[model samples]
Target: MEKPQRGIQSIEVGGRLLTTLAEVGEPMTLKDLAQQSDMPAAKAHPYLVSFGKLGLVEQDAASSRYELGPLALQLGLACLRRLNPVRLGTHAATALAEELHQTVALAVWGNAGPTIVHIEESSHPIHINMRTGTVMSLFKTATGRVFAAYLPDKVIEHYIDTASHHSFAYPKSDLRPSWKAMQKTLKEIRAHGMAQVVSEPLPGINALSAPVFDHEGHLALVITVLGPTALFDPALDGDNAGALRACCAELSHRLGYAPE
Candidate 1:
């Protein structure tokens, strides 16, 4: 492995104070900030003074508490502005496909519905009708269900109304016959942080999907992985499901999502 590059020790230590403030999400006194950073108040004061001059942090005159300054807000906004969920999710899905040896796809809420934007096929790709731009069923496919679970009721209801006029291959069974029943299903999906389908959308195929949220806690995209049922484990507690959730969680974190 290549040797790691050296860095300044003082700057790293000072950064800890800023990180603590961000995590605490509140103004903190110098002593409290020092304690949280595991440094002495005297040692941390100089860094705080330097940070205030740099506009990375500011102190309230009355409360005498330190918090992130305008510069910090600017930095955060800049980062959020550059984030492209689809681009980032596509890269993550590609790596996930390689790790799990299953086909992975990225879906976003399109004008029509949950539309697949990218697909990363496994070494032994499964033969399926799905491709980029294929809009999935809101109530049937795992991908669409994930969006339904997180999206507003109005959006889902609108799609359901449109589907009524057109044949979307909705199963005749009591999949979501009533609004109450649909809410219950959505509740379960939200609780589990994912949705799964076994041999329904396509016979002999199993799939699982999880949502990626932005910093605002809004659904940014959904990542779905599918494979032949015989080869894929669809259990919620299974290894495949665990890996899929982990992938989504990491992506969500990158998007600045902090789960409550």
Candidate 2:
């Protein structure tokens, strides 16, 4: 094995304090911060003092608690600005496709509707007509429903009003006939943290989709995984759904989303 590269030990130790504050996500007293960082209060104080001078952290005058400083905010914004959600979502989809051995797709809101932007095909072929730029149904598709559940009501209503004018394929569903029922479905999707379709959009096919959010808690994209109905479990509590949720959660974290 190659010899390990060496770095400053003090910097690494100080970094733990910063990491702890970020993870905790609030102002912390010196005692709590040191305990969480697994260091004595005396040891952590010197690092905090240095961090204060560097603008990486600051202590509240009234509460006497430490929180991230303005420089840290600038650094986080800089990183978020450099991120491309589509690029990152595609990378995540590729890994999810391999892990689940199912077709995985990434969709973003387009002028028409939720449009597929990328696809990672499985080793086993799935005979769907989906491809890049394919616009999915806001009510019928798991991918579209994920967007509908998170996106603003006005946006969804606009599409609903002009849905007939568009040439997009909307597979038949009970929700199609009733607006109130569709709202209930959307609420359920939000509650479950994902949407699922079973043999509707296409016979013998099932899909599960989850949303990825950005630093501002805005929906960044939707990731959907699909396979034959016989092989894929459409259960919201199944292993497949669990894996998809985990993948989306990790992608959301990478995009700087901290859920409240």
Candidate 3:
């Protein structure tokens, strides 16, 4: 009554076909894969078809190509929900927004970059409208830059390369030579555990962002408060710098970070 002993080896050619095709970042024509993998078109056909059906890969009609599929998203989201970093963030964001009379956003690094999937907007009309689910680049934004600044150089470099090719409506000066400002920004972020952008990326908008380090001490998310310049008090250190640092520390603590 033993099982058939299922494994990737059960597939044609022992899953070598699947491994090779899955590694291709962009879609590739079946013909191209057959040629590259040294497998005949007839032999490769079933693997692509079976893998695509399982959602491990996808096929494009116009080009007759295959690439990774949404199943990865399905799995990743399941993991994130179990981790529930957002739940920890939710309570903190609400409390802080109420206390400060400003907006609170919980952003996570994602495909489009730091997306604000949760937001509590200010009641006043003269407030910044950073709505939920708003996505941005990893460089030219407070939420985005804060995450990029805190992440390791490997992560930063990958995002920078991706961001450079990404399409966005901003001045070239804002993004020229991507790493130029990263080191300086990272120093500020590491020292204060947060980063600030004033009247930047847009007029009249100011933001303070802090890293939400996970239990493993890696940045898992970022909490950012943004508003019009008039709403922010330009003084915390007995000076503006001190006050901003305090804000960063406060947000970091709300995420369970005990500063040393």
Where model 1 places Cα greater than 4 Å from the true spot, the runs are 163-176
Best by lDDT: 2
Ranking by TM-score: 1, 2, 3
Q: Which window of 10 residues has the lowest lDDT sum in candidate 2?
A: 166-175
> lDDT at 199 for candidate 2?
100
Of candidates 2 and 1, the better by TM-score = 1
TM-scores for all candidates: the values are 0.92, 0.91, 0.57
List the global CA lDDT of all models: 0.90, 0.91, 0.67
lDDT (Cα, 0-100) at 101 in candidate 3 = 73
* Model 2, span 1-260: residue lDDT tens: 99999999999999999999999999999999999999999999999999999999999999999999999999999999999999999999999988988999999998778999999999876998999999887777899889989998887777777666655645334225566667898899999999999997799999999999998999999999999998898899998999999999999999999999
In the predicted model 2, the residue pairs found to clash are none
Candidate 1 per-residue lDDT, tens place, 1-260, comes to 99999999999999999999988889999999999999999999999999999999999999999999999989989999999999999899889999999999999998778899999999868999999989787878899889989999888877766655555435534234666677888899999999999997799999999999999999999999999988999999998899999999999988988887
Alpha carbon deviation, residue 53, candidate 3 (Å): 52
Encode model 3's per-residue lDDT on 1-260: one tens digit a residue.
Answer: 98787666456472665556645546788888777777898888887788778887788888778776788547645755566677767876777777677677888877766788788776643444457777755666778778877777787667655565666423445454458657787677667666677787778877777777753467778887777887664232323344435544564554444444
TM-score: which candidate is best?
Answer: 1
Model 1 lDDT-worst window of ten: 167-176
